[model samples]
Target: MGRHSLPDQYGAGASDPRRRARRRTVAIATVLVLAVAGGTAAAVRGGLLSFGSSCQDDPVRLTLAASPDLAPALESAAKRAREADLTSDGRCVAVTVSAREPYKVTDTLLAGKDPGAEVWVPDSEVWLQRLTATGGTADVSTVGHVASTPVGVAMEPTVAKSLGWPEKTYGWLELAGAALRDNSLRLGAADPARSATGLLALTRLSTAAAGVEGGDTQAAAMMKALSQRISDSDGQVLDTLPRDSSGTEQGNPRRNQALVVSEQAAYAYNTAADGDRSLDFFYPKDGSPRLDYPYALLEQTGLTTDQSRAAIRFMSYLDDPPQRRLLERHGFRTSDDEVPDALVAGAGGSGPQPYAEPAARPASAVALQETLGVWTITVQSARITTVVDASASMSEPVPGSGRSRMDVTKAALQRALATFTAEDEIGLWDFSTKLDGAKDYRVLVPTERLGDRKGTGTQRDRLSAAFGDLAPVPNGATGLYDTTLAAYRAATGSYAEGKFNALVILTDGRNEDPGSVSRADLVAQLERLTNPERPVPLIMIAVGPDADREEANRIAEATGGSGHEVSDPSQIQSVILKAIVEAASRDGQG
Candidate 1:
């Protein structure tokens, strides 16, 4: 059978007619759910998911972890489900909810521990993408988005009025410029590494600013400016806003007058703060990215058949009209088209604000990576040792890129180098079988501050020249294992205490040096070299079709890093940044 299923649901299996109809429109992201029943879908077709007609067979109890902000609303909906005695095939469906930060939860799951939940309702699919991006396949499946809210800049009414908020619409860059140019305007945001809201806004700002003159420089400047007032998380960033709507506290360096936040957050804050302590919102004319709370089933939770079916049953209950109202009352929109007038007003949006307009398309996984990379580098800086494969295979032409892998890889690396500031420390290495004296790797540039003067110019200048000089050594075979081990040792041995220390290796082929150390030995050495007190993440990028992703994954994972596969070298820059941000977030350094 060219198919997979949980015993029954397709071909020989059946499904609930009502459920099939309702779930047809559910937002399916990465996972497809097949309802499981003991040997037959008939029992599931009935209101009970094959459980006996008793409420006390331990009732299919499921635990869920939800994004902090969305947790309360989900709890309310779950409470209603329990009160209504919602059941899966006559068994009671009991779901317990807990609030958890998305980044922390993702890190927890990636570390291969029980996240203490069978279901996860993250604030956005972006977090889910991060999981799938690095791990190749995430062990989670999305049923539907329970609720949504657009991300926008929220400001005090007085400050918003001064900028012509209600009547005048602004693009992301225009609004960002306003915040930067006005001395009285203090703009803040959540650290992009931790908050999808902050990352999306920053990504949009980068897009908007790139269309203008001096884009790279301008974008870098904007990132630096925004980083000055970044908070650790969404909740922390909100706390930076003035306590009152009067805008008097906006003058204080500590209180931000404007912030990157979600519409629902603005609504909730306004409703609770009331009178003079309310906020106004500016939905960018271009489009506001949104937080779509996706109901994800954590597949690795060891859930029983009954438990899995019961989780789906609860998700179905959330889709009902009553639960939709519960989400809205908690300051959210069930769908983009059904904007509530009172909710919009309460969220500090009014006529001409584009509040009812359709949401902007979510940024691609690559875009999110680039945005986060920029934020991490600009704010925290880094010490990176980039190792490139100078193996003969790198000379092969990429299918659609019209350039050899080596050519494109070098260009991408240089582009990535440009995003770093002079304060950052960077180095370069090239490897191939028997490159020098039977050694697989040779350091072309020692890791040093980019701004530090060397011979006739700075270290950055020297490194750029070194990158351009790289070429596939004549008939050089890949020496991946030995090169990786040597680089890992170098990176961790010199871990810069105050900076993000990392080793980034870009390879186009698997280990071709039979004489090199065994894969098991290489991984063992890397594990021994890795230390939390002196953290150094190994970011391995396998380029082109010939690169070995599984090998890369095995070796990189030993050092608390990840292996990524790119079809072409053009994606190298974005991938590098993404890897760094992932490492930082895992360390809770965001």
Candidate 2:
């Protein structure tokens, strides 16, 4: 109104056409500009824009439970993930890796009640599938493969040569025959409950022993035979390795012990063995099981700030080429990429090591079922002898420790005795002046009377009482070799068909009664008694400062069993459990 200098005769009669058109155009232009600006702002607010001004601040932390078998590779992969910065929110992520048995880990991961981890890498894919099959609201996704290797008999070249290697594929029968027949041959594998690799190996052996094509017999006779050889429980096995390796090699060749290990470990060991050549790999002729390391993503357990970042980062890093190369250098095959030539050359001096089958063997559903069935049926027929060294030396307290060696040995044996089901045949042998009670070392009772099949409290109470009553008897020098002979003789007298036989020998000192029963003589006797057709395995547990390493090795070597040396009383239960696990199951599945 104030600037109406051009008020033409457009007032009430007619409108200014150009003015109206210009006004309408201005309104349309304003609307168009607002729509464009708001859309642009919305895009920015919604995070669809190309440039982001801010990011999540907190770091993600991932807790990973991995099978002990793949601990090495996963550890290396974890290191690379952090370096590559492939995290979920551009923040640093921390990965905490814990190594445990594949079965235990899978069971724990599947239960999913506690604050769960962000990821789990088991030694076998079968575990992953088994975990998922156990119904749950959570969805644990299987990440890309990690590493693979076939189970092999780890032995010295000389031993392998004696067993007829290179010229023929080494089957479990040959190994079993050697272990049972020869007094010098030594064989060892981890407790099935403690190691996926060990379990796979046992499973293969059980299948071969039963002549079951593609089926794992849980109750197979071979399983019982194998189980009888485990000297300690799962926890104890881990500790025993270091204990047995105690005291540096310094001019002592007997200090070196051979173990059936993963391919990567074998490679590392071979590289370090130098001129000693004490360690070598033995691929079983019965077609070894492929190790399909499965890294599964745990979805339900809310990740820590760092875990979320680590989970995404680790996966992305493994998918990258350069990081994959590092894994290969460490004797691992990448799941998504080709095996590096260097790795191939390292494996076999030429091409990649060809397994009996492909690395990614499917977890057979029928095979698993058959194996489980066999385990339930066959577990009971095994006869177990718990050998305890009640020699005077066991009464002496461990130097700088609280409990006596005898007490610790009893605790371990008690724990092992508790794991036996009713169907099993069990007996007890206390070696001192002579084998206790059972007239000249005989079976105490059929295990069925001990407890219910469901593993009830009744059995626990009976075992506890039996273990508690073991008084520390002050006797003459520990007669390990003699005690072993007496026990074996007693076992052969009443040995049953279709039954697994084992002697669990616990000692705390050297075998000093060499005048009448020398170690060499005892070993020869054991060889004759444990003839391949009637294999009777022996497991030994050495306790106290004076425990003879050489003697323990002799017994284990002669019997195809495992021997363990213990210093810590707390770890006894684990050691005994592993031995029982080894004796009860075949091919590690049981």
Candidate 3:
């Protein structure tokens, strides 16, 4: 206002035409220049005019989710990178690290949900494999490894001494036998389905058990025994240890005897104990699974070029010599060929040495899936009603096998029963044309608790006997629709609390009985009967090439389950187990 004030004393100039014209032109020019300058200043204030029309000073923000145990080192490295003025291209970067459990993160991704992270640092590559198996949308690539650790048992020094720790060698079977034989030696482990270390331990146990005669039976029994000592998380499992007592050879007898965890975790715990050496890790002599901490870049749809560059920069920073040393200090091996001296000392070793015996072989995805299936069965007891088709078609011999389809199926079912625990409740039914006088299905065995055997033998024995006695009626027709509807209704009506309630239907042909319900009506009724809060999954195992797999799938889909088709009855065991696993995975889903 002071510079552009119109002269109040210019009355004469206003009256003079030429003089007024000249003053007006000059004032207009000045007003235009002022307006331009003000607009430029406002743009600068709004961060729209920085770096010559490019806002390069603004830091690109990146979010990284890392496993809870490894998050501290990642955060420290992030802070150091920021202090060092790490940038992406010509722009500054800001990274925020969050601690999240690997399993929870995997579940979120598998549910077709984004975790709002541009980078993820899972404790093992197994999670990525699982994600891929589940058809997750997140495209991830491993940039590099941050640290390495192996799965092993962490035990009290006293227990180790009793077991002849450094002087004696022990494998999974030896440890499992000790736990089974001695109730006083309380062994605890994390849930295998939820923890990589737990999964590795369980796989090792399964592999060891599979080598012996009657392996599946022995494995199931051993797993059931160990299930009693399982905890929800690794930290919880370690918490079972006795409180430290200064200068004592033996810990409190009340504490847990041993726990399955990663070598790094055990080292961290011992380090936190201030060199008291109360706990030490025991690498099973047979072998162990190793965790290679992979830094994965999650390329989400919304991720920008700048963010991607920033993630790469941060990943590279983690692999640098300085940050690698930081990882070593946290009780992790930074290299594959050589163990760091600090990690060796932290793990209670005198000199550099291998963490654990080299793994016999990496666990395959299929093997892992099967292991998870077994674990699911062991952890939760199922209430199942099995319906078998006794049509004439079932009497046909399986291709390349001398046994009839019915015989093969019955044998498979008998074997499958061994995987179930004593608490699981099971029933048997056979369906054909007019099997129960007016009814299409007949109950061969009443549903009862497997462990109960008051009048007869145990439920397992009764079920086995009934299965062996099953014979397809001559000239019988399939009653697929009516029997499925009736079985589903019965299972739902008698659904038990705190257990998976479901129907296991094995069929070899389509509905051939004219008096049975129509397929459309059955599917519609099933859809209407489905309740998300109280699920009664219908797992259909379709055997032989003639089985109506499409109808089976439709019915199962309506009730939040799945259908598995086995072209050969001899392969029914695998198909049945797969169906159980799929149903378990969809337990909480609608």
Candidate 4:
């Protein structure tokens, strides 16, 4: 049939009572089905689907496009649905799970436009609004609350005590003041634009600061402060929060993703992290926005018989008592039906939760709103950049270094990539020995390639693999000058649009033959890039006994970036992420 032709339910001759009653639904479904059929047929015609099964699967496959942040909860929900035999409801329901970065999942689902997958569960409701604003066609009525948690600082218990935890209601003022007072105080949070939790955290802070809770002004101010803080730190604090705070019993979180994430993520980490129960929660005194993850069925897309049944069944299972109990066991808040003692003990509920009605009256929305407004004005941004050192100093192990510079670089790079998000892109390149016969240079992936695709998870996977493949390759002298130039060119290439770029350079020592570009010449180029018209930020990182610290400073000064020196290789990753977070703001790429 042609694309415009309606489905069987909307056929002109159809006059059945059931069909008429569901006319609007049938019309919407017909449109979605035809679109899918057309796309699938086209894909098959072009050999994109690869198999005929894409067309044959009309029996109905329920695809679930969800945020990676919610993987733990929803996966549990799917398991429950399957155990209950929801798949046998004559619809041949199948749940296909696809993971995306938190802020991007909604965009991904809309792209597919299949509507065949009756349900989509994102990490936050704010993102759902973003999707809808972008012309979401689905019936939003199906959207319902599924799971939620508040944003809190996941810290080592010792760290919490040092920061004056439960005894004094740890709030943003204390947290920020402590970090400012003590250089050793490490703090972490997610990138606001990248994940709901991060955005919510920013919102909470903004609301508290501006005295305008949950408003755009608060969001803007929070973005500004967040940008400044991120600009200062460069981006290290957020990178190590999860792993450093995780409980050891659950296997260590793979170094393939960022550390500071949602409460659910923190829970997963603590569950897997094998260490002292030293980890604990630190809620901001202002009362941050709770991470409210919702599951909504898209009415715009017509679900296959199986998908329709599966979606409803899954929702019911989520609200069921047994499933709620399972969620509670995993360190999440138990349901109102039954709060497990184990969960209560683990959660350490010192205050009222948003889910259950409190024995005492809950805090007023006006009070909470006022606090959020204040937070928004005071929020700080987190900025970060990953720099790799590929100079000659890296070829050999230091006499007292214990490990080769190259080895340290690879390990640090791997750790650094794991701490970044689609929102944070690190410029990558390396300098090597240059023989008269050949050019000594290597640039892995440039900064622009990071998170280029709006909703695809490819960038994350690509970065993970690249970091995985990095190893000590001894070859040439350091080309810090030339590579920095390349990075500068990439970051500042489009200055007219008013972009904030940070150049993070990893170097073992001073620049050798700069490939015709003298040190002075390179500095001038950096100056041009950092011009107020362009404003390219710089962060220079060095590791080597004889490293040229002076040169690092000069490079950073040229671009208005910072220079950091670290002797301990183990701490480099956190330092970089924290530094970046301090430097970048919510206005910039948090």
Best by lDDT: 1
Model 2 poorest 10 in a row by lDDT: 1-10
TM-score of 2: 0.49
Tell me the whole-model lDDT of each prediction, alpha carbons only. 0.83, 0.55, 0.76, 0.52
lDDT of 3 by residue, 1-590 (tens): 00111222211212235754784687567656756777756655775445332222477788899987788888898887666556556455678999888988888887778887988988888899888765567688776777778787777667777877666767888877776676767788888877888887888887888788867777777777778888777777878776655534234544577888887888788788856555766777787688877778777547787787777767766666888889877877777667665665566533112353454467877667667777777778778899999988889998788989999998988877877778889999999889888899999987788888867589988998999998988999998888998888888888888887788899998889898888889999988888777788898978888887887888888898888788887666666666676677777443
Better model by TM-score: candidate 2 vs candidate 4 = 2
Can you give the TM-score per candidate against the true fold? 0.80, 0.49, 0.82, 0.45
Tens digits of per-residue lDDT for model 1, 143-225: 77778899999987778999998999998988998998756798999988788899889889888876777565567767878
Native-vs-model 4 lDDT? 0.52
Give the alpha carbon lDDT tens digit for every residue of 1-590 in model 4: 00122233222221245643574586557556756777756645775433323222443456776666566666776654544334324333346666655445454454655534456766666666655533455465444666655566555665556656556665544455454343345444554545556555654543344443333333343344344333111133334443433445233322211122444455655565555642455556556456555766766676555566556555555665676667655655534344454443343323433213322122333323232322322342112234576555566775575877667667767644543334444545555655324544566654553456635555556666666565544555666677678667766764324233556677767777645588888899788766664455677877766677777878777776667676755546544544353344322422
Q: Please state the error at residue 166 of candidate 1 in Å.
A: 1.8
State the displacement of the C-alpha of residue 390, model 3, in Å, after optimal TM-score superposition.
3.0
